[model samples]
Structure formats: C-alpha cells, structure tokens
Target: MPDRAPQPVDRQLPTDEARDLIALVRDIVQREIAPRAAEEEEAGLFPREVFRLLSGSGLLALPYASEHGGGDQPYEVYLQVLEELAAARLTVGLGVSVHSLSCHALAGYGTKEQRAEHLPAMLGGGLLGAYCLSEPASGSDAASLRTKAVRDGDDWVLTGTKAWITHGPVADFLTVLARTGGEGARGITAFLVPGDAPGLSAAVPEKKMGMKGSPTAQLHFDGVRVPDSRRIGDEGQGFAIALSALDSGRLGIAACAVGVAQAALDQAVAYATDRTQFGRPIADFQGLRFMLADMATRIEAGRSLYLTAARLRDQGKPFSRQAAMAKLFCTDAAMGVTTDAVQVLGGYGYTQDFPVERYMREAKVLQIVEGTNQIQRMVIARHLAGPETR
Candidate 1:
C-alpha cells in the first residue's frame, strides 16, 4: 500500500517543536505499538511493555510540568501523541489518558508537599493510575455518588464501591472521590488511595465489547484507610477537581477517536483500491469514492476540533465546552468512519482477521466513557446557554 496521504495542515497548527514531537510519537506508534496491538487484544492482556516504552520515551509526562521530571509539552502536542498511539492501539491510548487524568488532581490541586512526594513516581515511572469517580448509580451524575470517607484521627476511612473503573485491577494508585462533608458535589473529597491498601479490592475484570486489553472492573473500598495527607485539595474540592481533570481528559479521548477514524479511513482506502469489482477497483466507482471522501473529511474535521480544543487548553482559556464538543463529535465520527470501513471491506471486514472490525468495536466505548456523548451534549448546551442559565 502507498503511504497514506499527509494530514491536512490547519492555519492554527502547532509550532516546529510540537510538530517534531508529533512526528516522533507517530513513528513510535507505527513501529512499536501497531505490531503488538492485535495479539495483546486477542490475549486480553494490558500492554505493560508498551507503557514501559512510553515512560522511557518520556511520552507519559507530555502534558505535565518539566520541573517534575515531565516533558511539559503543551496539550496541543500531547494530544496528537495520544491520537497516534490510539491509531495503533486504543488500549494503550486510553490507559495513558486515564493515567494522565489520575495525575491531574495532584498536579492541579495537591499541596506543595504532596507534589514533591508523589509527582516524581507518577511522572517518571511505568506505573499506571486509575481515577475513581463513577459508581453504579452515579456515572453521568457523578456528584451524587454515595461513597463515604470518614475522618479518623490522622487518616480517613473510605467505604464504597466505584464501578466501571478503568485499570481497576492493575493500577498502582487510585485517585478516589468520596463524600466527606454534606451531600451533593460539595461534600466530596479526592483521596490518593494506594492500590494495595487494606480493604481495597477489585472485582473480576469485565468482559467488554471493545478496548478489551484495557481492563474495566469495580473497585471495592471497604474501610480503606488513607492518610489525611493524601487528600487532594480542600475537603469540598473533589467534584471541581474531577470536573477540571475531565475537561482535559475529554480532549485526549477526542484525539484518540480521531486517530481511530483516521486508521479506519486508511484501511478502507487501501481495501477499496485492492478489491476488484466490475473488472476495476471499487475505489474507481464514484459512489464508493464519495463515501471515502466523506470519511476522510470527517476525520480531518474531527482532528481540527480536538486540536483547537487542545490549543485553547494550552492558552489557559475556557476549554470545557470545546473539549466536550470535540469528544462528542470525534467519537461519533469515529463510529461512522469505522462502520463505513467495515462496509467497504464487506464480509472480510466483519471478521477478526481484519483490524477495521476491531476498530469498529473499539469506537463504541469512546462514546460512553469519559462521560457519555449524551452528557457531553448537555455540557456543551449548558456552556452555550451561559452560567446564569445553567
């Protein structure tokens, strides 16, 4: 197959340094991640080796501060790296994104002492992290979570179950949100709970429709004790912290969606050219070619949306609405593009032998996780309506 067409350049594209990082990440994804993605997915195993490689490559800390062993790259550059990784293997991409979100609480809200003690391990190591915000009854309405944390001298005793926790079983640490004050979002507090803490346990891994290599499990916090020092920010700041982290995390997911869409589009284009029909390639037909054109267009638009949001984030501007829009649009486009990719491949596309089918399966979860697309719409709508209306 010929090299895929160069990505369209936007007027607001990144600087030379950002472009170089994007290129490096793309090279790493194609060389190191693409080959192992299928096998790892088939085996239902998380790609620990890939995480180690990324840590060594300094990719894990792309969006963090350079003072703490991080690359401190702008979100505009960091998100493209995530996109490239997701194009090769979504499990790794999503895992890295979640880990980054887990670190956000510390980076944004932790005390100076907390940052000094924990940021190094988080930014420098191959260890993974999990964000504990969702519960069985409090996914979209996360502020209503019933997880409780009671003060106990110099520590807090946590007792609750966090459902749908990505990397639940294997994470080195979990940034847990629990009720500490009154009720609703204000009562919540964020705690950095060690994975191996007593009374903390993970349920059997969930069998999912996609992103199978990334484990999803329920985290049981049965009287888990955490030092008061592990609390992130003020006692009533958990909800705000979680929301802030998600604003950035949504961009990561959006970028991943764009990458997946691009991958599907590339596969469809290649397959359309090779599979002959009516004594000529199907790609020669205008009708099918139109579909390919649409797919390519959507992918580019999605890329543009996420990049714009990333730029807004880098500029320290209001990015919540844009992030939501990007997440909603890109994931929906990914689903469309991947489904079309399968149609272009016909019977072969539906089978395990093809990566497009896997891409299609993986696309569905992006719509659900990191706040469902429905929630994303609500966010965008609320933002558009202004704070007074909200």
Candidate 2:
C-alpha cells in the first residue's frame, strides 16, 4: 500500500502558515478525534480526554495572544483548524468554539491583571468554558434578559437562569451577562464567574437531538458572589461585549458548518465508490455523481465565505455582516449537503451504521445555535440596508 500514498495537500489559501496549520489539524483529527467520535456520541459522554489532547497539541489556544501560552495564529488560520476538528467530531469542535467564546470577554475587555489571572487557565488548562447570555425568555432579544447582578459592598451577587448553555455542566468558567442597572442593553454588564462559585448550579443536561456528547444545560445562578474585580468591563458594557464576541463566534460556527458538510460529502463519496448497485459503483452513475459534485462545490463556497470573514477580522475591518452571511450560508449548506448525503446512501444513510445520518442530525444545531440562521439573515440584511434603514 506504500503508506496509502500521501494525500494531496490543499493549495495554500493566501498564506502558507494557514495551509500548514490546516494540514496539521487534519492529521491530528483523522488520527485521534474521529476514531472515538461515534463511541462518545453514542454514550452521550463528554470528551474530556479529547480536550486534553487538543490543549496539548496547542489547538485550543490558537487564536489567543502568544503571551498566554497561545499559538498566536490569525483568525483565518484558527478557523480552518476548527473546520478540521468539526469534520471529525461536532461535539468537540462546538465545545472548542464555545470555550473560545467564553474567553473572548477576558481577551478583549479584561484589564492586564484580569487577563493575567484568567487567560493562562482558560487557554492552557484543559478546562472548557460556557457563555451565559441567552435566557429562557430572551434568546434573540438578549438585551431584555432579566438576570441581575447587584452590588454588595465589595462584591457582586448574581441571580438568574441561563438557558441553552453549551458546556454548562462541565465548564470551568462562565462569561455571564446580567442586568446591573435599569432595563435595556445599556443596563447589562458582563461577569466572569467560576463554575464552582458557591451558589452556581447546572441543571440536568438537555437531551438534545444532536451534539449529545457536548452537554448543554441550564445554568442557575442563585446569589453567586464574586469580587468586583471579576467584572470584564465597565458597567453597561456587557451587551456590547456579548455582541462583539458573537461576531467572532459566528465565524467559528460557520467553519463548523463547512466541516460538517465536508464530512458528509467525504463519507458519501467513499460509500458511493465502495458500494455497488446494478453491478457498478454508484459513484459511476451520473445522477449520484452530480449530487456529489454539488455537495463539494457548496462546501468549498462555505469555506471561502468563512475565510473571507476571518481575513476581514485580521485586517481590523468591520465584519459582523460578513460573519453573519457566512454563518447563515454555511449552516444552511451543511443541512442541505447532509440531507442529500443521506439520500445518496439510501437505506444505509438512515442508520447509525453510517456517519451521514449522524451528520444530518448534527447539522441541524449549527443552523439554530450561534444566533439561528434567521437572526443571521436579519444581521446581514441590516448591514445591506445601511445605517439609516437599520
């Protein structure tokens, strides 16, 4: 087999470093993560060891500053790494993205002392993180959230329930948004709450349709107390921080979407060639071949969109709209590609015996989370409509 002939390297996309990073990630994911994904997902078990592996490999801290033991890679490179990870295991990839979102507040808004205290543990420790912004009543309209953080002399006491928090049950820390003033977005403030804080508790994990291994739950904060030093930014800045973090987070989700679509396409292509129908490989059939071609085209398009958004971020340009577009387009593509992949596989695709079915289930969440495709469309439309219309 001559070592199975080295896989042709993907062409460098604007930078050799980015290409190298993607290849490294792909190698790690194919060798380690993909092997255990089905078992973990079947048992609804969290991939603690996998997170340790990622941290050890320096993948967990790719986009953070180098001073904090990070890889100091650009977002453009970091996102492609995420794509490779997701193609292997959605649970782990999503966990990484959510942890990165949780760290964004500290990286973007924390004072020097705060970053020194938190960044190393978050970036280097094999610990996961969760973002607590969405409440049961305030999913899209986060500004109207009722969670409260009241000043108590030298400390702040938080009380609220955060809904649909990824990594909620096992996270080491949470970046929480709560109302510290009057109503509306301006009244909100961000807090860095340790998972073991005295009054913080996580509800039983949700029985979700997909990404079951990633542990989603409701986080209950009942007078969780922390020193004033835990606040990420000045009063009334939480909403802004959350929104800014989301712009970046959306790109992460978009990358995950592309990865999921790619995984489906890969599985479908392999199955098509190996499984024969009418005495010939189904891959040789024009109709099935066209479907595979379409899947590949969409996956590449999704990849390009996210990479473009990432490049804009690297250049310090406004990219919220681009991020939203990528999120919307790629996630929808994932859903479509995965669904068609099942069609290509026919009966086997509907069963756990194949990966495409699982890919389809996993693809649905990408469309809903990170501000649903509906919200992404709204954000993109608002951007296109200009400031006056917005």
Itemize residue pairs with steric clashes in candidate 2.
Answer: none
Q: Give one digit per residue, the lDDT tens place, for model 1 in 4-86.
A: 33233333435787777776776777677777788778889888888888888788888999888788788988887787788
In model 2, which runs have C-alpha deviations exceeding 4 angstroms? 1-20, 387-390
| Reference-based lDDT, residue 250, model 2 | 97
Candidate 2 per-residue lDDT over residues 127-234, each given as its tens digit: 778999999999988899999999999899999899999989888889999999998999999999999999999999999888889899999999999899999999
- Poorly placed runs, candidate 1 (over 4 Å): 1-16, 386-390
Q: Which ten residues in a row have the lowest lDDT in candidate 1?
A: 1-10
The alpha-carbon lDDT assigned to residue 233 of candidate 1 equals: 95
What is the lDDT for 365 in model 2? Answer: 94
